[model samples]
Target: MDSGFDLVSGGTDNHLSLVDLRKANVTGKDLEKKLDEVNITVNKNTIPGDPQSPFVTSGIRVGTPAATTRGFVEEDMKVIGGLIWETATAFDTKAGEIRAKVAELCAKYPLYE
Candidate 1:
């Protein structure tokens, strides 16, 4: 929300957040690929009234369980949210910087330590 993205169903009461990508002028397919290129994993999803097909959705589902298991705190999530916004808005220009930040976070909490 703070990152200028809309949440489908208003907001989440649990660990998942469904981000509508219409306002960002990108498709869930595009953003998912971009995020993946930068090492961020997310799933494409369809929002209520989505005009796009399920395979090329207008939204992406973000979840916290994996990050939480890796020891990501709220502050780290804020940075990640900012990174997601950057990836969605200026991916071509900020991909390197975004990847670096992601590496820093992953290094901070090793996945299999």
Candidate 2:
């Protein structure tokens, strides 16, 4: 059975996708930490062929359109990128601070009217 979710060439139909942690050496936990630092919210996902539980997957999926709609541009992406690097590099030391920052960012660019 083939779901339409899969592309014609057997690829996934998505604009942005996450690489598997086992293949990339970066875990979803680490990715979440880094994204938080820059106020980028993301959800962890299971690898395409993995049998692991979805709640504890090894990949992080990112969507940029939401941020863009909230007025984020390329320059903002640079700032977010830096923060992601820092948070991932120092997860334990930065989680709390990053959470607060994420909250602030959301307030600045609320999702709904």
Q: lDDT: which candidate is best?
A: 1
Candidate 1, superposed: residue stretches over 4 Å from native: none
Cα shift from native, residue 108, model 1 (Å): 1.2
TM-score (all chains, Cα) for each model: 0.95, 0.53
Estimate the overall C-alpha local distance difference test score of candidate 2.
0.59
Clashing residue pairs in candidate 1 are none
Clashes per prediction?
A: 0, 0
- Candidate 1 per-residue lDDT, tens place, 1-113, comes to 78889889888899999999998899999999999999999999999999999999999999999899999998998888889889999999999999999999999999876
Q: List model 2 lDDT by residue over 23-105, tens digit each.
A: 33456766765675555787777777654567666666656778888887666655554455445555568777766766776
State the weakest 10-residue window (summed lDDT) of model 1. Answer: 1-10
Question: What overall lDDT goes with each candidate model?
Answer: 0.93, 0.59
**What pairs collide in candidate 2?**
none
| Residue 79 error, candidate 2, Å | 2.1
